[model samples]
Target: MRRTWLATAALALAAALLVAGCSGQPLSEREKGTGVGTLLGAGTGAIIGAAVGHPAAGAAIGGALGAGGGYVVGNSLQNRQAENQQTQGQLQQQQQEIENQRQQIEQMRQQQETE
Candidate 1:
């Protein structure tokens, strides 16, 4: 029983090492996207892979999805930054209008008092 436990522990450690080693490399945007894709794909692939008798292929498909996804994410972030600037401009315009209205009301009140 002890030997069996030791073997299981060793196998678990080895598996951890393999996964860690696979992930230890530096990640570029494309690679990062691909790796995430691979993982996400793998989860889905595991089901499909099991049916197809090839989980690796599933991981590959996921990697493709991830790469595409990452590209989209990068583009989206850029678009959002541009939108933020436009929204900020609009917010400023609204604030200025509010301030102008307040000033106009104050002027009208003063004119009534004088009359």
Candidate 2:
């Protein structure tokens, strides 16, 4: 019984390490959220499944559903972020145009004063 417990602990630790090591690049907020949701869902599912004497099946189903839901939410958030970036770019462009117009007006005024 003690050996079995130790093995389980080791396996869990290894799984965690695997997940942590799989990424070199920092995850975006959306990916982070999805990964968190998936991990949490799988853990919850496993516990519930164990109580019902079918932990493996429970974890599988739970993980799949959780991942799908997480992906959808993450994708939506990413889209919003992209949209915000585009809006910011547009605002900057407009500001530049306004500055150019001001400069042009100043140039015209100076020419008139000289004449």
Reference-based TM-score, model 2: 0.72
TM-score of 1: 0.45
RMSD of each: 9.4, 4.1
lDDT (Cα, tens digit) per residue for candidate 1, span 15-104: 754676579685444444444554565457545765787655554565456557766765566567678989999999999999999999
What is the Å distance of residue 30 in model 1 from its true position? 12
Indicate the worst ten consecutive residues by lDDT in candidate 1: 26-35
Counted clashes in each candidate structure: 0, 0
Give all candidates' CA lDDT scores. Answer: 0.62, 0.74
Candidate 2 per-residue lDDT over residues 21-56, each given as its tens digit: 677866675776577667666677677887997676
Q: TM-scores across all candidates?
A: 0.45, 0.72
Residue 64 alpha-carbon offset, candidate 2, angstroms: 0.9
Clashing residue pairs found in predicted model 2: none
Off by over 4 Å in 2: 1-24
